[model samples]
Target chain A: MKYRHLVITDPAKLIFGTAPYPVKTRRGLHIGGGQVYSELNFTLPVMSINDQTLPEVYAHYRQITEGALERALQLNSKGVILEFETLLEMTKSPATGVEIVKIMNDICESFYQKHGLASEIRLTPNDLREFERPALQRTSRLLEPMFQLFEQGMLAGGDLLSIESTGGKEVSDEALMMCDIKAVLFSLAVLGVRDMQFLWEKIAALARQHGKIPAGDSACGFANTAMVLAEKKYIPTVFAALVRVISVVRSIVAMEQGAVGPDKDCAYEGPYLKAITGIPISMEGKTAACAHLSPVGNISSACADLWSNESVQNIKLLSGMAPVAYMEQLEYDVRLMNTALKKGAAYSRTLQQLLVESDVYTDAQALVLDPSNVIRISSALIQGDSYVANARNGALEFIEILEETLASGRMTLPEMELSYIPVLREELQSIPDSESDFIEMMLPLLDPSKFIPSEYGL
Target chain B: MNYILSKLLEAVEYGKVDQGSPYPPNLKGMDGAHELTQKALDAGIMPQEILETALIPAMGNVGRKFSENKIFVPQMLMSARAMGASMAHLKPFFASGKIKARGTFVIGTVKGDLHDIGKNLVAMMVEGAGWTIVDLGVDADAESFLEALSNNPGAVVGLSALLTTTMINMGEIVEKIKENAPGTVILVGGAPVSTDFCRKIGADFYSPDPRGAVEFLKQLAS
Candidate 1:
């Protein structure tokens, strides 16, 4: 909302590890404007949690943290981000996630003070909305625990706050599978946008109160679901491509509300988010194979401020534990980019182009992620005055890029995927220009019971 | 084929729920599966024929198209809704013992995982294939599956998990189910659940798409 259109209009200027608005974290870790940092996500091995297991769980987290940081130091790392994504079990046990945050922060403090290794922890609580039947996302008491954990985590020294929020995912799940563009728009642009605004408002307020960075939200539940489905070949890649584009507006609402740069890693829509909003983003790519598979493995890091390996468990590997091994992998990836940055701007741009070239032609899901294409789509997005209009414009722009990309022989797509372009184009173009008109047309098509319009404040 | 029966099948295949549903714009302003289904019955078509010849076959084609990537989840859901619309008229006959459904399928998202879109899709596709679905909803543990199985014996249990975090629960759940019902056939699926993981967990089957689950159940039924 600060700026309505594309901020970084020049694709060459939109490289990773830097942004127009950089977020300076506590303990002297300046994100977004420096060399790319490593954000290592580590989870637990298969184990039940209770009072008896709490000690083991605490020991596991300590082992992963010390182990990874020791390896980071061995590589002469600039800094590190340990994303303490709390499990549902942790949240159910009061202050367990918070205590882990305290443990991590103390270790980080020791690392910074003793070894001069700057680091911070991003606390992402489990979104428990899906635990409820029908998931009363807007007004469920079930959701308050998540915010409580966030507040406690920040108080206990969590630096950056983010959530893989699922506000509009109930309807979006169906829309994505059916390849229903209009429903996807309604879910993301309307309901998801409003939910981000509402949820981020609270998060932003909390961040402001605690003097912590309110890192933005991710449409992982929506766009990532589409991406995974596409990767599995259950849905058209074109559909996933469009979902990625449409998701940007919803994620940007966090910035519009108050959250700032360095959006979460799993939001593959981060490049476009960075292009439009000029916020540094944390992106995961090929190394994220430990967590999940994706076609955006290379291109995702093209504009990333923090390069991540998604999440790996605390199991042992030949080299070391999974988290420590992935940390070494991530440090090397960012080291290459930082070396490129150090060489010169011309060399950095070349590296960025190489990253784009490697993945762009391979998958339609990766095509829209090219920085130039991101700027184009962001330009088309700002042409619309409303969220609905912007979403439609963005989706149409994705198809336009695909059509142009295919026509120019820059890429080759399957005939099945190629055949969907015109149909998707027509469907997107058929949407009304105005928000109210679009909503009117969509309401009768969507089941009234699936989504509560009142929750979206429609 | 009867004239009304043909219209009903076309309506169901195209996802026409009623004259009011504004989908598949080509079929606008026409009676959908809801009205045509009742019409076929009133025209003296047997309810079993409508269920078998029209609803079951149309849904089978829908599932096949889905498996072939010719269609997606929305179209299949529409076909399911269309089949649901048609099935409403045949429910009474099914209750009166005039018709019999294929066996039951009990499904749920594994514990600590709250994703249901995948599970729901499989349930809908399986139910569309004319099976009774006992949907345990989300966050279902082994006890819930056992309770549902106790209520519906010979049921095929399908466990779904959207995260690698919760997918491990499938192993525990599968073991618990096998401990009680040694002969139970279990199916596992989700974003992270693969055939290898399914095999490692000792589950009977794993499919990436809902249509594959439908086909597997069809083969099981056969």
Candidate 2:
């Protein structure tokens, strides 16, 4: 509202009340833009979710999304939308897939219905056989339970330190905010998720409001879809309408925020998969919003500068996964992450306790012991080349906070993480942070690591 | 100093395709790799000299830049485009025996992986370095590699994969290629691949960047 072309690279920065000042990366009517990015990794251990907490979990998911979209509407006058990986998650049971698809459809249909945009939106049928067959075929029955566990872990951080009870849990306005793994999983599923067509279809009508879905700007996971498509030798027939739901929501905010800067950006990096399948269209007025393009081969290493929405889309249409050496970059980045973690652990007990578990010191230790969520944050930021402010890596944040808390002697690392809950509660659109499941989600970003110095060796 | 060759190298590094191509705006309307190579040849410069002095070194510079994160895919591909345009002029010489290749490199994305950007980059770089390239294309299984090796004896085979799942095929392909021809020097590169992976799979070498692959070929040929 205060500026033209407001673009956010790291959502965490915003959540931390450090939203970056708008910068013009390209020329266009960039009303509003935010990098609503997420990442997922199979290397992290997964956790199970009980049937009892499904309703609360679903509600929390809805609150985070609906809240974000509503704010997006305030910016662009058109609310963004969201979609879950129900279809891919349901691959273990085709019948269950059908049931979950119906639920997802209801979720989208209701959102559009409430917004009076339902008539414009169109959802698709179960179409796993087309682009996702290879992924589905690679599915092992043994891994089905693990996927469910991953979903649970993603939806609610691993039976986290703070989330003791889902039933009738009193969420006060003062509690810290947690992250939902669903968003991370939503993008991560591109590697080989089935029935994405159903999700993409729901996003189609939503695209009419914004025009083309800026794929790369959505997240690092979008580029991974190109690998999936190339592997399946599949190309989507309909390209313009589909976008990552997170982007659909964030762009609405970018639009409504209504930055009036010269050459305000509205175009973003098109998903590489779209280059093969989407009909070429001029991004002139069809430019929707800016997004983040990220690394796919391996998550956790800084690879390339974050592509602006302008160059990202133009580049994708120009080429389709032509110079494929990202995997090499991933390998190179992991070594760096290990080095950082090893170093940060040496200088601080805050980091050390994260790795060690003490019944007395619960919160930070919980995040340290559970590294999956931490990796998710790492995965989200590893692919960024550079940003207006900085990229979000939980470990790096931990390291930074660890250094600050030690120097300032003001708040402990766990207290610093807990401190943000109130801010998230204030900033969130729909639900209060007290009601949300964010402990495990925020832990990796908020906690100090427990790395023992390499010199100490113990 | 070969003034024309240096211009050619600069053209290849900056991705000046030809006089009319509108990319790399700073170098617009200037003679590109396409024009410079032809001019170098017209000046009686040997095709081998152009490959060595201009094309190879230029691609090497681009490859190193890519490793250092100084450039990205679009820029690298633009460089490749420039290299490809210049290399086109030398094809006839290679075919007619006027320019002898340093070696032959057979490359593909390996079985189970259809991604080819990395493979193509390596292919262009090796080709720019004066090696004959037999591209097996994506989804290449063991048989295609073995067949390529049989057709071009002493040809170095390159394997590429972009996914961890797809990368598994490299080991299988290497084992089969070694079984078929024990002395075949196989090179592997890709996102999930590492030098450790190459050694474990019994491949001769693995490079994280395209320039490294070119370096290996240069060493092998010597």
iRMSD per prediction, in order: 2.7, 16.8
Off by over 4 Å in 2: A1-458
Q: How many residue pairs clash per model?
A: 1, 40
TM-score of each: 0.91, 0.42
TM-score of chain A taken by itself, candidate 1: 0.98
**Candidate 2 C-alpha error for residue A33, in Å:** 26
**TM-score of the A chain in candidate 2?**
0.24
Q: Candidate 1 has which clashing residue pairs, if any? A: A178-B74
